[model samples]
Target: MATGADRTAFGPMVIVAADQHEARPLIDDPWARRLLPASGRLAAALTKYRPIRRALIAPTEKKIPGLWASMLCRKRYVDDALRAALDEGGIEAVVILGAGFDTRACRLPALAKIPVYEVDLPANIDRKRTALTKALGRVPANLTQVPVDFNTENLADALARHGYLPGRTFFVWEAVTQYLTEDGVRRTFDFLATAAAGSRLVFTFVRKDFLDGTRLYGAEAAYTEFVRKRPLWRFGLAPDRVEAFLAEYGWHEREQAGPEEFTARYLRPAGRDLPVSEIERSVLAEFTG
Candidate 1:
């Protein structure tokens, strides 16, 4: 299997469809189209045709069942939360852990004035730099790419080395927890626990039941691929216990949105009838310090 860097490809792939959606898109990031590989760019271009789009998406949806739609909803939710926090002021910095092909730093105008760090595996960071250069002619001046291997490195120390100061900050940990070990996840929280008062964190996680093979949640194919077959995913947090879990790290859940809420907030408004997977959900939390 390829390393974690290889998995970053999926991030751009998921958002490109939403970027090209016919109706009101849940999220808008034209940078997603620019960040893709040649074949992906071709596929993205083909999606401009409705019939071709449906035919291409139908099989993936049948196998993963709402994976694409749910991703779009989560992206929308996180983007809104980040913007709201930024507008509230006092946000000193933005740290995106496991930041893959995410384009927020380059595309979002609000982020242009803030110190933004994108932390990922070294290989992925290199890939991101190349993609950003290719897509935007040059990376934005406000962004910094930090490379760290979570399994062996200390999160706090690495960021500190990169000029990260502990203050009111916003952290994004999207689509990352499940791929990490339980200890890895806890160690990251240990770092978060030390953040200054009022730091915000937004993250996505798979349900423990789904991870353990107890409940497939209509995503049997995905479960088989990422869990049973290759075992790419390593950790899960029980939904009901997420708040208590965050509390252990000095964070309080502000909002935890699942499929039903996503459908109501994003899909329905956009006139999309796609089902959202119940296995994965997003949590927005604030550090109590």
Candidate 2:
């Protein structure tokens, strides 16, 4: 319910919070509840009850359809990918690009022993620090907060100044690409291209048609709010082009997943059949060089 860049940070935390209330949640993020604003915390608390969940949460999920599932599914997907990469053994560090209120550094045990750098806007970084402090008493020692404005700053330089080294790293860019322009996305990719071979990248992107209003994917309300009204989203990529796009940047696409893939892989297993928004998709790519 925030505005501007900060809105992205808040919205996902709320979704995480709501997801936590599920009986068999695909993701576990109790810290999400603690890190929310008062209003968000109230919503999280109210939805804990069965009646409120059916009356309030169910209606919203119905209206938005796959919106909630999409967010949760992508989160689970990234988490699984990160864990598998860690298991394969070669990643030197983890960098969370455009990290908002993401608690992965604190929540995931796999990251507990490795160096983790969280890069984001200064304002979001500050808020994240405060929220983490309040929610967990202290920020985890393994995690370093690196503040950078992607529009005007050099990501590589920022990471270097923060002690990030050139090595095989796992980068998680979640729910952030749509807010950046094409040049911005390329700039980040240019930096990623410099990473050592075998480095992994997991990110989420919206469909190009959705951004240009050529397609709505049955979520007109989301388009009206995020596209036309506020005009916060700035870029999108077609699913078919994802492979070539990653190849152009020296990244080899490993997997590209959307609603159907998510429902089959994550939702149905938990005895849930929630629809996921078709407007978005996630990809796992590895540095080829």
Off by over 4 Å in 2: 1-3, 55-64
Candidate 2 residue-wise lDDT, 198-257, digit = tens: 999999998999989898877788788888998888889999999989988899999999
* lDDT agreement with native, every candidate: 0.84, 0.87
In candidate 2, residue 160 scores what lDDT? 96
Score candidate 2 by lDDT.
Answer: 0.87
Residue pairs in clash, model 2: none
Q: Which ranges of candidate 1 are over 4 A from the true structure?
A: 1-5, 11-14
TM-score, cand. 1: 0.95
Q: How accurate locally is residue 172 in candidate 2, as Cα lDDT from 0 to 100?
A: 96
Question: For every model in order, what is the number of clashing pairs?
Answer: 0, 0
